[model samples]
Target: MAPARKEKPIHSLFAGATAGAIEAFITYPTEFVKTRSQFGGKKEGPITIIRDTLRTKGVAGLYSGCMALVVGNSLKAGVRFVTYDSLKHKLADKEGKVTPARSLIAGLGAGMMEAIFAVTPSETIKTKLIDDSKRPNPQYRGLIHGTASIVRREGISGIYRGLFPVMMRQGANSAVRFTTYATLKQFVQGTMRPGQQLPTAVTFGIGGIAGLVTVYTTMPLDVIKTRMQSLEARSQYRNSFHCAYRIFTEEGILRFWTGTTPRLARLVMSGGIVFTIYEAMIKAIGGREDEQ
Candidate 1:
C-alpha cells in the first residue's frame, strides 16, 4: 500500500493567505469605517462617519487602501501561520506537546516576523488613508496615489516609519492571542468526553474571545503605532514614544482607545472567521494525527 502524504508547509501558508484575504475583503467596509472613526477625529459616531465618508468620497473611498491591506494581510497571515506551525512542531518535538508558554513563544516569533516584513508598510498606508480623509485639503486620492506620494516624498524609510511600535504591539498581540487559544483549546478539549474532537463552533467562539482580549489589552500600543505610522504624511510628532506620550498626556487615558468599539467588533468577526478557516483547512488536509 502507498504511504500517506504529508501536509505541505505551503498548504498552510496558502490557507492562511486565502482566509486572511477573504476575511479582509468581507470586512473591508467595516474596517474603513473603523479606521475613520478611530483616527479621523471627526465628531460623530461610526454610522455617521461611514455615511459622511461615502457621501463625500463614495464607495471607492471605503476601499481606499484595500490593495495595501490585501497584500499586507496575505503576507502577514501567511508568514504568521507558517512560522507558527514550524515553531510549534519544533517545540513539540523538544517539549512533547503544546503548552501556553511555548505557544506564547511561537506567537512572539511569528509576530516579530510579521511586524518586520509586513506590518510597517501596510499600517503606514492604512494610517495615511484615515488621517488624509480627515484633512482639510487631502493630498492623494486613493491607495495608489497615497503609496506613490509617500515613496516620492519620503522614500522607502517612510513606509516603515513605525517599525518599533508595530513590532511591540503585534508581538504582544500574537503572544496573547495564540497562547490563549492554545491553552483554551486544550482546556476545552480536556473537559469534553473521551475521544471527542473539538467542535468547529467552539473553536471559532473561543478564538473570537481570545482575539478581543488581545486587541483590547494591546490597544494602547496599537494607538501609538497608528499615530507613528501616520506621521509619514504629516509633521505631527517626532517618534513613536513621543507620539504615545503626547497622546496619553494631551488626549487622556481614554484617548488610547478612541475607536475601540469598531476594533472589538472587527476582531470578533475577523478572528472567528480566520481561526475557523484555519482549523478547517488543517483538518481538510488531514494534519491532525490524533485528536484529544
Candidate 2:
C-alpha cells in the first residue's frame, strides 16, 4: 500500500472521508455506550447500558445520534488528514523529511481545524441526545430535530458549548495519535527493506497501538469535553475550567476516566480501520509525493 502522506491532499481527503464514514457507522454503538457510560456510575456498565437501551428504545436507541457523528467524524477525519499533510508538506525539509516537532505542529493544526469546523457542534448535539435518552420523554428525536431544538432554545452558540475542551482534547489527541503512528510505522519500516510497504495487518496494528497511547494521554480532556457538551452542562458547570474543577473535586480524579473502556474500545478499532482503509485507498489512487 502507498504511504497516505504521499497522496495529494484532495485524494487524502476523499480517502479519509470514506474511511471515516465506514468507521463511524461501524463503531457508533460503542460511542453511544461511551457517552452514556460517562454520565452513569459503575452500575451502568457497557452490557447493562446496551441492554437498557435496547429494552427501552430498541437498536435504534443505540444509534441515537449516529447521523450527526457519522457526518461530523467523516468531515473531521477528511479535514484532519488534509490539513496535516498540507502543513507537513510546507514544513518538510529540502530532502522531504519532517522532524518530530514539525509533525507535531501539523497534527495540532489539523486537530484544531477539525475541532472548530466539525467536532464542536456535532459533539454538542450528540452529547445532548445521549443525555436526553435517559429521560422518560426524550426532548430531541434525531439529529435534525436535536440540532434544531438546541439552536432554537440556546441559539447557535449552544452547538459550540464545548469548543474549548473539544479543541484541547482533539489537539492532544491528533498530536499524540499521528506522531505515535508515524514513529511506530517508521520503526516497523526500518526493520524491512527500503521502499517495502507495510502489510495491511501491520498497518492496522500500528494504528491501534497509536490509538491506545492517545486514549490514556488525553482521557481527562475527553471527560471534560463530554461533560461540557452535555445538556445539563449549562446549569451544572460554568466553563471548561469549572467543569474540570468540579470533576476533580466532586467526582474524584478517577471519575475522569469513567468511560475509558468504551472509548478505548472505539478508538482502537477506529484507528486501525481508518488508517488501513486510507492506505488502501491511497494505494489504489497511485499517489506519490510529487503530486502534492
Candidate 3:
C-alpha cells in the first residue's frame, strides 16, 4: 500500500468550515434544545422542553443563537480539522501511517486549540442567548450586543467563563471522535482497492458511533461547561472543580448527564453529517489522507 499524503492547510480549513456550517444549519434546533435542557436543575424531557420553548418563545426560539453558533462552528471546525490534519501528517511514521497514539495526540491538540480559540466564546454567547429566551427582560438583545454586553460587564474573560471545562470536553471530544472514526474506518476498509472510497453509509455509521463515544465519555464535563457558560453574574460555583462538587452534591451525579437526549441526537447527527461532508470534500480536493 502506498503512503497517504497531506493536503493543503487551506483546503482542510475550508472543508471544516463548510462541513460545520452545513451541520450547524441542519441540526441547530437540536443544539438549542440541548443547551436549554442542560441548564436548570430539574430534568425536563425533550418533548416538554420543546413544547415549553415553542409555547413561550415561538418557533424562532428553536433557532435562537443559531447565527452565532454557525459562525462559531465554522471557525471551530476549521481550526480543529486543520490542526488535526497538520499534526497528524507531521506525526506520521516513515510508512505514512498514523498510529493510534499519534492520531489521538493530534486530536487532542486540535480540540484544545479549537476550544481555546473558538468554542469558549461562541458557546458562552450561544448558551446565554438560549438561556435568556425565557427571561421576562432579556439581558442580551442580539449577538453583537450580547457579545458587547459580556465584554463590558465581565471584561473579555466573561466570554470564557467555562474555558477549563470546555477545553477538557473538547479535548476528549475530538480525541475520542477522530481516533474512533479513523480506527474504525481503517479496520473496516482494511485493504481497499486503489481509488476505492468508503461508502457513505459506513462513514455515517462510524461517525455516529464516534459521536456517542465522545458524548458519553465527556458528559460530565459537558454538563459542567453548560452550567458555567450559562451563568450570568451569579458565581454559583467557584471553579470547574467547585462546580462539579456543587452539582454533584446539590443536583446529584445524574444531573451531570443533563441534556443527554438532545445532545445525543445532535452529536449523532452532527458527527455523521460533518464527517461525511468533510471526507467527501477532501476527496473532491484530491487529498489521500482520509483517515483523520
Candidate 4:
C-alpha cells in the first residue's frame, strides 16, 4: 500500500560485489577454458583444453588465475552496478523511467569505469598467470607474485596491457547486457500484478538471455582483448587493432570467435547467477522495494 523508497547506491554496490564473487567462483573453469582457447597461440577446443589441462596440470590448473579474477571481478561488478544505478537515476525522467538508449549509455559508462579501474589490470594479471602456468617453468607463483613481477618489470602499464580493447569490450558488453536486461526486466515486471515482485527464475532467465545476446554481439572484441592481454603476446601484435587484423588475416574470420563455446556457456550461467544473487542481496541487505 505504501510507496517504494528509492534504491540506494550503497546497496547496489554490496549486492553487486557479493553477486560477482559468487558467480566468479562458480563459473571460473569455463572462464579458464575460454581464455585458453582465445589465447590462440596453441588454439584448442573446450574439450581438448580441459583434457590437456587436467592431464598436465591436474584439476587446480583449471583455476590457475582464479583469485585474481575473483578479486577483480568483485570490484568490477560493484563499480559497474553502482555506476549504472547512479547514471540511470540521473538519466531517468520525473517518474524515474529511463529509455533504452539512456540505459545503454548508463551501462556503457559503468562498463568503461570498471574496465579502466578493475578489468584491465585484473585481466592482464589473470591472462599472464595462465600463460605462465602452461610454460615449461612457470615464472609467477600466484596472484601477488604475478602482479608484483609485472609492476616491477613493466611498471604500471604492464598491468594495463590491453586497456583500449578492454575498454571497448567492456563498454560494449555492459551496454548490450544492461540495456537488454533492463528492457526485458521492465517488460516482465509490467506483466506482473500490482503489489507483486519478480520471480527469481524470471530474473535469472532474463539476465541469461541478455548475456547470451552480449556474447555473440561482442565475441570478436572479447577474443581480441584476451589476446592483447596475454603474456606471450607482448611482441606478437603492435596494438589491439593490429592483433585483430592478424587474427582476421592469418587465422581467418572465424578465429575472432575462438572461445565462443566456453564463453557462451560461462556467460549464460554467470549472467543468470549474477542478477539473481544481486537481486537477492538487494532484498536481503536493503529490504524489498517491490513494485506495486
Q: Which candidate is the best by TM-score?
A: 4
lDDT of 2 at 196: 81
Candidate 2 TM-score versus the reference: 0.94
Backbone clash count for every predicted candidate, in the order shown:
0, 0, 0, 0
Candidate 4 segments whose C-alpha is farther than 4 A from its true place: 1-5, 287-292
The C-alpha stretches of model 1 lying farther than 4 A from their native spots are 1-7, 40-44, 93-96, 134-138, 193-195, 231-234, 287-292
Candidate 4 global CA lDDT score: 0.90
Candidate lDDT scores, in order, read: 0.78, 0.88, 0.87, 0.90
lDDT of 1: 0.78
Candidate 2's C-alpha runs over 4 A off are 1-5, 40-43
Question: Which digits, one per residue and each the tens of the lDDT, describe model 2 over residues 94-183?
Answer: 656677788888889999999999899889988998999889998788889889999999999999998999999999989988888877
Candidate 1 residue lDDT tens string, 1-292: 2222233578779888877887787777767766665552434677887787888878877787777887888888888888887787667633245878889999999999999898788988877877777666888787788988988988998788889999998899888988888788878977988657688899889989888888789888877877676644257777777787788787788878876777778777888888898878877876544311
Clashing pairs in 2: none
Which has the higher TM-score value, candidate number 1 or candidate number 4?
4
Q: What local lDDT does model 1 show for residue 3?
A: 27
What's model 3's lDDT at 225? 91
TM-score for each candidate, following the candidate numbering: 0.88, 0.94, 0.95, 0.96
